[model samples]
Target: MVREFKLPDVGEGLTEAEIVSWLVEPGDTVAEDQPVAEVETDKAVVEVPAPVNGTVKEILAEEGEMVPVGTVIITFDVEGEVPEPEAEAEPEAEPAEPDGKEAADGEPAEPKDVEATSGRVFAAPSARRLARELGVSIEAVDGSGPGGRVTEADVREAAETSAGEEATEEAAADADSGLKSATRKVTDDADEDEPSTDTDGAEAAGAASETVESADRERTLAAPSTRKLAEEKGVDLDAVPTEQTQDGEPFVTDDQVREYAEAQQQAQAADAEAVSGGAEAPAGGPDIEAGGEDERIPYRGIRKTIGKQMERSKYTAPHVTHHDDVDVTRLVETRGRLKEKAEARDTKLTYMPFVVKAIVAALKEYPVLNSQLDEDNEEIVLKGEYNIGVATATDAGLMVPVIKGADRKGMLDIADEMRDLIEKARDRSIAREEMQGGTFSITNFGAIGGEYATPIINYPETAILGLGAIKDRPRVVEREAQGASDGANGEAVSKEVVPRKVMTLSLSIDHRVIDGAEAAQFVNTVKEYLENPELLLLE
Candidate 1:
């Protein structure tokens, strides 16, 4: 039986993706669920998996071609049975030549099919044809593709260096430029669009900088990445033009600097050749192989969802962070005492339960902190009830599973509920509903060993609190002491400073919905409860 593999909806009603590369080609056998192609969407690169085990009968799209969702990307001939489309696939192959031949080169000749089905390309088709006529495999030529997809560019580039473009191709292939090469090309274009401020001796000589003017103009401005790129590329920043905007900001653009530096390097290389009569090639030239093999996977599925949410939260919320430290010694002792009782009551007691309890109390006292900013209504929706979300780190990503009505649950109940939610999250068993509708969120990065972090506010919710690691530290205290000499028959009493457990609490709140004073007060309230865990019972 034959099957057609359609691009399933990656996520979020996304409609199309650009075919970056194919992992398999026609005639290659593949297994079900095996990754066959890498597609690039607007946000990320995604691996497209095969739907069924079969031999590829046809490839419907070319690398760098864009296809709509549900489009047939490949056809499979199961059990060595060729699909009927194999006969029809000729038309698909023949039409591409008449279409792209002109754009690739000035002349139209018999175009060799340049299929990168298995991700190997070595030379330009013309070069390949030339090599084939000369009885050579183009593979002998170095590839400049991401994985060294041998390109006309790489062939021409290699040809210029020496007669042995073959050796350079291997060396270049070993150096893998892929994304770095593409980025460099973009950088070159970007450089022309913007000029760098750091000019070299030639640039300085051309511009004729005076002692008085150069000294006065030094502090005013620069291109964004020009100085940095110049330093990396060995181009002096002072020699490049500063007439580029760094994203509308007054700084330099990376392109402007890089272009200037590249030109300077080329000039310096020529000068070196003239002086040393072909001295060990100048310091830096194209290392088109510096970027390791980069598979361009499309941003789809869970990562795509995360990107949207983060962008929304970052743009929509005016976030403010507040920090405070609390001595958790008393709370630690209280938890130790409550553990047995909690277990007897069928509740697994932990420090988080105490923290959750304290948060519930604080929310009740400061209702505004437990509110959401409703953009549609132009008002703040103060949640009369507490639906606390505990951010759980999962393999998919970070998910906040909420336990609604946290105010109603006792510490033990909260602990049990939290355990269930966390377990479900880790197992990827958390339902969509359970992960949504959170009024507020708390992340315990302290478990991950961080003293402070400015957490991004969970969207719509006003605040998020990050807990830091707890550690023992010296604390000062007053104590009464009696001398042994004062009571010969009695014993001497002494007091001294002691080390106690301390924890840091960092709270990030939406300043638009919460004020600095309110955020500070909330932190102080949480600190007070943490310092004295017994007060949790009063709630």
Candidate 2:
């Protein structure tokens, strides 16, 4: 039986994806649920997996091609069956090519088939890694698994088979050329559409800094899952060898990747043990190139979404910002005392946990700040539950991961959840639901060295609180003196300046939903709890 595999939704819900790389090609075997290609959506690069076990027969989509949803990208023949295409299998339109541009040497655009997914390589990450560690080329190993998938065992066997093998095909080619080895940059989506190098020195440097256009990527081939796994393990997938290939292109799996990384670490440790030299000089960072005027880069994905949401909020809400200072000396002391206890229970505690507790306490008394505006119905929706959104700045943009029912949780519980959510947001692994259903939001600029900021409301929500860095400043303290010169009865009252910890709080409110006085009172309540953190224990 012949099966046609269409590009399934990779959670973006977008209509199309740019085929980044094909994991398998015609004449190769594949198992059900195995990844066959890597595709780039608007915000992420994801893998397209096979739905059936079969031998690949033909591919409908080309690398660097933008394929629409439900379009058959690849076809396979199962169990000795001849393949046939159905009437609906016809492409609705031609797959869009990356922006047509000339190559570096004044040649026309490079061929789409260059290093294309025109062949098949199937191997686990571990197997590929093992081949690399044993000094074997992944493309040289023959797989034995179904669909010709390479396994760890296959890698071990290949190593044993080539224990004393001669120089590899790659090495032989290098020797035959007898030219100094060199590397060329493989273009990514961010690098594609860039005009070939035409200038020298600084002008050329500016072009490298900003991309003038965008196009498809033709870089290393690996499943999106494998790529993410490699990131989490601090391993470089490109450094791992693979035994599987499509038209001579290597594919990577997870296990071999981790194994290879571990081996490298062990080797580095051994080398360090054998050396008794002084510390090496720190490596210099990448050169910062000056920018060129009139360089315009397309703003899309999360950044575009953020812009739209921000515009809506700013235009729709009547914002009123209130600034105040908080003396959290007691809150700091209490947290420090309990931090060790929290770690013993396998929970990590941060100042945000205490801050959240204080905010929730204040919200219970002033429900208006915890409410949302229902514009269509023109009603104020007072939320009974307290789900607070914590704004975290990531490489992509700002992401708010909400902590659900925060009022019901303890300091430790809130701290742990916040830690996990922040990590997921920064890594772009957070889910849509995790960022929604917030009654109020908080942004801590203090973590990144800011003292205060006027935060814009997260639309529909009533308010947002921005925290500033905590610092020690001189504050007046009252004490009794032995002399009666400035006497209160028989004793003299004296004032002295002492260093005290302080933090600034900037609260932005939707004036339509909350009054200026109400907002001030709510913040005071928060301030009181933090100042007398012992009161928090009673709650």
Candidate 3:
């Protein structure tokens, strides 16, 4: 019995995924729950595990193919059925050949006929596509992949060999034609002017044909976006040098293409300067050639998902940003005091945990900021639980990992769990559930050196707080004089300016649900807790 496995929805309502790679091939035995393939959804990359123990019978989908959910991707022979005997059962060596004339003639068989006589050929889908593009016979190329699977490189090499043979034959045919034309020219004087004209026309036609053939031979391995980049930059993909190779072919990336294009532009600039008597170019000016082309990345995967989410939030909600600076000198001092204690417990503490606690305390006071607007029911749903989402930057894009029951966790616990979630998010190992159920989000652009930014609210959530870089600035402080006294209250006051640590906060809220005054009050509440770090203990 053969069992089929379909692509499942790994993320919430995910309709499709790109097959990144296959870990197992046909005929390979797999265990239950074993990962057979890795797929990239709009959110993250996840492995598809086998449902039961079986030998892989066939892989229906190819790497780089976008497969829809519920589409069968692979088949497994659960009953341990042997398929080798079927090949041996055919009596005639050329089972599919009706005449068997090629065998009788002692000529070698065609590569495609081998598969017809046998069963299916073991080759990657990409290899087959490349073979078709290059006009190479895939069945004729020897595979270099595991289990003797044909790869893209094998097809390219075979195409080169075929092209060389065709070129030789064409040269020979051209030579014979030239010889015949020369002989005819010597025999007939009436058509004397025609020979020179015909020869010139033939030479011109041959040169154009060679140029086309040369362009066709310039092939290199690159992703679709990289290829697009190369085209836009007016740089040939084959001309780009790269240290990476996929399936034994030179693989070009978007960065490599950009570097190559920049080099070309610099070289051209130097050449122009040399020709113009070494005139110095404008300082810090953009090169006209470099500015002509715009870099384009394929809008898909995590980046695309983020774009859609942002668009929805911006268009659906009227966002209002309230910016203010907080005196976190005490908060900084408190974290410094607790830093060593956290490290003693094998934990690295950061200011995020303190900020999270402050935000939770403020949210408790202003429940409206922690609620969602349900337009369908014309009601504002106020959330009772505190699920704080920490917006983390990753190689794929921005990912927010939510901390559940944040109000109940201690500062150290929040630090530990937040660190764990951030690490997992950066490495893309976090599950979907870990990123969901957030009532509010915090984006710390401060970690990257930004002063302040109006962070868009994570959709379905009412508000998001943006933290800016902490810096020491001069602030006013009032103090009572040591010995001087006035008749009233018997005290003398003095004002002084001193340097204090300050952090800018930008709080963006859905204007429909939270009023501007309420938004300002919420930040003020957060500031009060942060200014006196000990007050967070009462939360």
Tell me, what's the RMSD of every candidate? 13.7, 17.1, 10.8
Model 3 TM-score? Answer: 0.68
* Candidate 3 Cα misplacement greater than 4 A, ranges: 25-28, 56-63, 75-86, 89-295, 483-490
Most lDDT-accurate candidate: 3
Tens digit per residue, CA lDDT, model 2, 378-475:
89999999999999998878889999999889888898899999988887767777888999999999987788788999988989999999999788
Candidate 1 per-residue lDDT, tens place, 347-457, comes to 888788788889988988899999987888898999887888998887667778899988888888899999998898776556666777788899999898889999998
Candidate 3 displacement at residue 437 in angstroms: 1.2
> Local distance difference test, per candidate?
0.65, 0.70, 0.76
Looking at candidate 3, what is the lDDT of residue 13?
A: 90
lDDT of 2: 0.70
RMSD of 3: 10.8
Predicted structure 2, TM vs. truth? 0.57
Candidate 3, residues 60-90, lDDT tens digits: the string is: 6667756668867787888556545423432
- For candidate 2, the 10 contiguous residues with the lowest summed lDDT are 178-187
lDDT of 3: 0.76
Best by TM-score: 3
Runs in model 2 lying further than 4 Å from the true structure = 8-13, 16-67, 73-296, 484-492
